[model samples]
Target: MLQKTYDSQICSLARALELVGERWSLLIVRDALFAGVTRFNDFQHNLGIATNVLASRLEAFVDAGIMERREVHGSPRQHTYALTAKGRDLAPTLVALTSWGDRWATDGEPPILFHHADCGAAVGVETTCARCGAVGHDGVQVAPGPGMPAEYLADRRPARPPQP
Candidate 1:
């Protein structure tokens, strides 16, 4: 069985999960990205997260290179967290997750909307094929790639016989 920690997995997704898979981690990133929340008090006020948990999550983010902590206002005491380039790169992932939630989880209209900064038009995440243009979930297929471990390949169920 695959471990919940996924330490043995060689997949990129597994590696990413290790960094920001905790419940509060992505929300912290979301606030940093969309709400411009930086300070510990601001995060606590916005998220209502406990002090110790928030501190630990922030430290993990900093250690993972997703955020940087720096002193605020040249005061050796006060500090703020800022997203690094790696953290900003999670925008699309968050957007996609938001889109899905808005579709299937919400009761009424979406509580928040995303807009294109340049045109001020609503935007959403979509899957597009490089050569064939847009595609839906049914149009996508997974196959073993060069990065697939031999053990993973062996564990995969045998391909079904071709339909008659």
Candidate 2:
């Protein structure tokens, strides 16, 4: 079983993993984000997920503010799940992950392709230099961001070489 929390970790990625690292969580989000899957029954049918497990995952997503549960129009006792803005923000992450999986994990060709909605062009994710806007995946490194705890930051500081 996957650990439910990364309470001891001070990293953003770890925190994100706490929510969507589960085997089914990202798949749920993907359907909602891409397929406009909002109805509970639709999710169950599409994913072949157990109803109880879907209910639990939806409840957790609602609690986390990643998704909001709303009553379906004209259907009492029935609910549809909608992604909150915070949840929709995960699209790029999903796209990037898909790109990596297509390249590394899957056989043959990519099963799906993403494209821009406003124009007929391919959509992809890339890392870029913040200051110069140069595009590449190299030279990336982690450091303490402003929100990191002081003690954690101090402990994680990269060792410096002696000055000449």
The superposed Cα distance between candidate 1 and the true structure at residue 37, in angstroms, equals 0.9
Residue 160, candidate 1: how far off, in angstroms? 4.3
Model 1 poorest 10 in a row by lDDT:
1-10
Model 2: which ten-residue window has the lowest total lDDT? 134-143
Q: Taking the candidates one at a time, how many backbone clashes does each contain?
A: 0, 0
Q: Candidate 2 — what's its lDDT?
A: 0.90
Total clashing pairs in model 2? 0
TM-score of each: 0.89, 0.91
Tens-digit per-residue lDDT, 1-164, candidate 1: 43547877768898998899987999999999999999999999999999999999999999989999999887899999999999999999999999999999999999989999999998888999999999998788767789888888888797774575
Total backbone clashes of model 1? 0
